[model samples]
Target: MDKHLTPGHVICLINPVTVNLSHNILVINCGSSSLKFAVIDPESTQVLIQGIAERLNSPDALLKVQPLGSQAIPYINHAKAMAAILASLGDIPIAGIGHRVVHGGEFFSASVLLNEDAVAKIDACRALAPLHNPAHVTGIRAAMENFPELPHVAVFDTAFHQTMPPHAYFYALPYDLYKTHQVRRYGFHGTSHRFVAEQAATLLDKPFTELQIITAHLGNGCSACAIKNGQSMDTTMGLTPLEGLAMGTRSGDVDPNLIQFLVEQTGRDIRQVTDLLNRDSGLLGLSGLSNDMRTLLEAADNGHSRAELAIDVFCYRLAKGILGLAAALDRIDALIFTGGIGENSAPIRARTLAHLKVLKPTLDHDLNSAHGRHTAGRITTTDSALTALVVPTNEELVIARETQRLLQP
Candidate 1:
């Protein structure tokens, strides 16, 4: 083992010999309607194969494998999807399985080797993440049944933000609510945030623990995270993914009273109001157009007023979230844009950064316009007070690495 200093100046042991290991880890990410699987070599961080089974439990169910081709399959549920995914992998020897569990509650502060006890703990958190954890549980159970002999590790999306201080994670609610029900914020997109922070550190040639970075993960689901010294200090998403910056469908950070107001005005039930906020809001509701940033951008260029307003609101809210998270840090080292929209939408990035002129963020117009899809580097000028970067996130690689760490001697 070789001793190395983390960005936070903590001494840690690095097992250099693990670099020669030929272990192939399977990474699984299960959503409400889809399951994505990847076979990655942890040592090389190379994805050997990956695929998805989408529209599960529906007539349109389809299983698509890369390097192969798309095909229709009968994936009635997550368990069926898991079975199909395993069958698609054929005879590939998998050393371990890594599952992306959305919420760990307070039970897990880091990744853990899954067992019956761990599964119970995860089941307990299903209420905390009603939209994600149950699906994860189904997938985990299915995977366990399929590969009973393999070591399965659970990598949580909330695990990285477990480092957040109480003041940052707690909401201004009744003390009893928090103590009795754990009604506090637990940031999501932890895997993406942690991955981009490390990539930013490497790109900046700085210690991970020495940098204060604000990462904006904009996609169908979006969140902003304030990472200081390789640990999450604060983040935008609250108790659920629905509390973050304006996402594709989620209405982020709306007033608590709005729900009651809508219910009273429209005579709709609480569940209906909740569905509106979570599914029919954000860019989709605002623009009356597609939820995709690309579509909104094109519409805005074509003189669509609602589309223009939607983009404006999205960028403004995103910038505000970034600036707000900045308060958690002593000094800002870099602003990282990642995920589907953050990495690809140059106009959106420019618009968001435009509001941060007070921070003296200088963007290289060419670099900002160029799509650095899978590359990691700075998009801001060298002399800018704040560095802006577009780093592609690889949460699967993070899960694979975590699995490798736990399985190693």
Candidate 2:
């Protein structure tokens, strides 16, 4: 225990059920329409309870708890969802609360204890991440109101990539726009990227500080990170999450002039056009069917031409991003794939890796297809110069650990 801990902070040491306070940390990840919550024991890295509140603020709001069950609860807003989550936990002791905030801007480079000042800073960054930070603020306020006594910590998605050099994070836009408005690449999924990179080090039995790795988080939201010597040297998602590889609905890396061209052609307002790119483009727009990769894959297999095109574009764009990020590294050590499409889709993996012949990566078909349920290990041949792996990311665990560290006695 640290000497900084006072008697007021000793309540965290107590168990919710009067059994033994097992040091359970409650991790919350609030999205625009849903909230994912988990109670994890950091000591053993075990998840005691995990669930999601979906369709929040809508009539179809639902709460699903793993290992328990689910119910259609009327969660009018994130506050109600947080209340329901607390009620579902019964008496499980929560040593602390960890909130996943998507963008911390350039102000925060690491996780910090949540205080009024911290909340204010996060609120100030709301404009930088209009789609995410506002929802995060809502969740934070609710959690702070509900668990006023417990220590609350905020773990940012953009924190890890703060190590990127100016040349890497800066755009070609006017220097004044960057200096005045803080317009630059602030990568998302830092927790996921960092978690898998460290896990890669353990799996390969190499010093993390001596490796150059590229991590691709492929899901509804995708980004590729270039990490050198255990620090983020560069990443794909820039300023916002919409600048990386084409996501489920996001049009990644579009030309700046496209906005003006669309505005002129469609006569839609800027916000509407932005919404179209962020919510109705990518796989959904290209396939004219769904934003889900599974659905696209199925359609492609059934000879759906548009679906096939969507998948091809996704893979090609992802490969390009990976190869481009590789330039930030002196040598390629491993190319790690995580997230939904990365961990589960063998065909997607094979398609993406096919374009990376320059790295000499050889994927074992059996190993790539056999790994199930977010298992972490190599999916490439042992002799391959650049190893490929499918390491499932646990951002919640990272949040929990950060919270516990901040609250340690």
Candidate 3:
């Protein structure tokens, strides 16, 4: 790492070992049974190539690539999948690699160059993120093995939120639980929030470090963040992704006693009840329809009572949550929306802003409608009190930029 580096003036240096030649970053995001990756040009933030290796170690394991198509790779594990990914790269040059690790816990506060000690620290944080951290470690090791010479960086989803104040992150639970077991509100979707916040700052023509913004990343998995002066002051999601907004299948913000209550009344075990909330609840549970927001919106328009109620609850809760996050900041410079639902769903945006009557956020209906898929910009009226936008987030691009920044010499 270089001792003298300036913001927005990062110079990608040549390494003696790998001789860094290009400015492209290979961004890898690993799930429990899938690896979604992209080759991004950090300078332009363009996705040069994108693909995924799915159902790893299963009989139906398959590898899919854009502009290349799909094919089955039998009994494909993470290492084999990584090898196939590297093999398919052909002549596209890569300067560095960026990996998305879901939970860094209290270990990493920012993106770090992957090494033995870094890997060990990441693994240690797995006690809190049992399901995600292990798979990330597997993918990191696999990528390191495949691209041994290239520098690899771990861009944590939790790293950006490590700046959160203890009062905001701590729950009302026992103090000993936080000290000993490391239990607290470690928010997710931080990468998306940070990306959109920076974009908001750019669009607002203000320094990110001086801007107070609220970002909502509402996809299948949803989370809201209150960013003050480029730092995560407070966020909705806590401990796990399941604690935030009501997601596609997650019943967010449920009663703490509901789990045991369901166990006693329904005769299901604690695990079963918990799974119900995590998997079977949310929009699907509320409407008894598909988890797809589009489907619910269409059904609601068709006079489906349950679907209408589901959409109502989703928008109400979302609006309420957004307004609630404002308490963390003195005044919000911008309330930006990103992710699938946040970016594309015009109705959701309108409905959400409608509930924010106190903020007097006037929406440009035409502008909101104009911001469909592949389009993003401000959607608030010029005279509106708040500047609300529909900024489409690119987590891979953010990871690539972070990789480039960390690779500076």
Q: Write the per-residue lDDT of candidate 1 for residues 1-409, one digit (tens) a residue.
A: 1111001111122243543335889999888888888887777765656778888988889887764657797647888788888888776678999999999999999999999999999989988988888889888999999899999999999999999999999999889999999999999999999999999899889999899999999988999999999999999998988897998998999989999999999999999999999999999999999898899999999999999999999999999999999999999999999988888788988899899988988888888878543335677878989889998888888999999999999
Off by over 4 Å in 2: 1-21, 372-376
Error of 3 at 358 (Å): 1.0
Backbone clash pairs for candidate 2 read 1-409, 2-409, 185-239, 186-239
TM-score of 2: 0.92
Clashes of each: 2, 4, 0
Segments in model 1 whose C-alpha atoms lie over 4 Å from true places? 1-21, 372-376
Model 3 Cα RMSD, 1 decimal: 6.3
With a 3 Å backbone cut-off (N, CA, C), the pairs that clash in candidate 1 are 7-209, 8-209
lDDT of 2 by residue, 101-183 (tens): 99999889999999999999998998999988998999999998888889999999999999999999999989999899999
Candidate 3, TM-score vs. the true structure? 0.93
Q: Which ten residues in a row have the lowest lDDT in candidate 1?
A: 1-10
Q: Estimate each model's TM-score.
A: 0.93, 0.92, 0.93
Worst 10 residues of 2 by lDDT: 2-11
